[model samples]
Target: YADALRVAQEAAEALPIEKDAIVGANFLLGLAQIEAHTGQSKEVVKTLRQLLTIPAGEYVSLTRLKIDPVWDPIRNDPGFQKLLSEPEPETVYR
Candidate 1:
C-alpha cells in the first residue's frame, strides 16, 4: 500500500499541468483511493478536497464515489460523509 501510494503521488506530481487536467485528476483520485484503503482518512480527505479544486474534478462521478469499495475505509469519516452528501452541481448545457 505504501509503495502504491508513493507511486501514485509521484505520478500525480510528475504529470505536467499543461498536458491534461483529467489525467492529473485521475492520478489524484487514485492516490486518494489508496489513502482511503490504507486508513489514511486525513490524507484521503485532503487529496479528495484538492481534487475538487481541479478543473477536471467536475467530471468525477459522484455515483462512483458513493459506491466504490475502495472508499469504504473513509466511508464513516465526517469529511468524507459530508463530501458524499453534497449535491452535485447542475450542468448547464447551452
Candidate 2:
C-alpha cells in the first residue's frame, strides 16, 4: 500500500503541468483505482486526493470514480466527488 502510494506520488510529479504529459489524467486514474482496490478507503482517498490535484482534474478524476469498481466506497461520498469537480490550483512549469 505504501509502495503504491509512493508510485502514485511519483506519477503525479511527472505531469505537474498539463503541457508536459497528456497522459497524466490516465495515470492518476489508474493509480487511484489500484489503491482503491487494495487499501482502506482513507488511504485510497488520501492517495487519490493527492493525485487528483493534477491540472484540469474535474472529469479525469470524476470519470475514474464513476467507472472504477474499486472506488465504490468513496464513489458516493460528497467530498470524494467534490475532489473530482473542484477547481485545482493551476499548474505551471518553471
Candidate 3:
C-alpha cells in the first residue's frame, strides 16, 4: 500500500496541472484508497480533496465517495462528510 501510495503520488505530481484530471485523478484516487486502507485518515481526506480539485471524472464523484467501500475507513471523518455535502469544485481546466 505504501508503495502504491508513493507511485500514485509521483504519477500525480508528474502531470501538468492542465492535464491533471485526464490521468492524474486516477493516481490521486489510488493514493486516497491506499491511505484509507492503511488508516491514514487525514491523508485520505487530503488526497480526496486534491482529487476533487480535478474534473472528477471516472475516478471520483460525490456518489462514488459516499457509496464506495474503499472510503468507508474515513466515512465518519468530518472532512470527508463535508466533502460529501459540498458541491463539486469549479473546473478550471478541461
Candidate 4:
C-alpha cells in the first residue's frame, strides 16, 4: 500500500498539475480502481474516499466505473452500487 501511494505520488509529479487537480487524482483513483478489480475492496473504498476530498475526482472518470472491464471484483458490492447512484463530482467532464 505504501508503495502504491509512492507510485501515485511519482505519477503526479510527471503529470500536468499539482496536488489538487484531476491528473493527480487519476494516480490515486487508478490505484484504487485496480485494487478493486483484484479484490482489494477495502483499499479501493479507502482510496476513493480520499479522492472525494478533491474538488473533483478521477475515479468514475469517463464514468467508466460502471462499465469498465476492471472493477469486476466489486461490481456487485452494495457500496459500489450506491456510489453509482450518487452523483459524481465530475459528471460534466466524464
In model 3, which range of ten residues has the least summed lDDT?
16-25
User: How many clashing residue pairs, candidate 4?
Assistant: 0
Residue 61, model 4: lDDT of 43
Q: Pick the candidate with the highest TM-score.
A: 3
Q: Over the stretch 1-94, how does candidate 4's per-residue lDDT look in tens digits?
A: 5676557556755762354466667776667765775666666766665565555533454266677767778988777776767765543322
lDDT to native, each model: 0.74, 0.61, 0.76, 0.63
lDDT of 3 by residue, 1-94 (tens): 7787778778777874456555666666777888888778888878777767777756777878988888888889887898899998765555
What lDDT is reached at residue 50 by model 4?
Answer: 59
Give the better candidate number (3 or 4) by lDDT: 3
In terms of lDDT, the poorest run of 10 residues in model 4 is 53-62
TM-score of model number 1? 0.73
TM-score of each: 0.73, 0.46, 0.75, 0.54
Q: Pick the candidate with the highest lDDT.
A: 3
Q: Between which residue pairs do clashes occur in model 1?
A: none
After best superposition, candidate 3 residue 19: deviation in angstroms? 5.7
- The residue-by-residue lDDT of candidate 1 on 1-94, one tens digit each, is 8899899889878884446666877887888888888888888887776665556434455677788777888899988898878875453322
Evaluation by lDDT, superior candidate among 2 and 3: 3
How many residue pairs clash in model 3?
A: 0
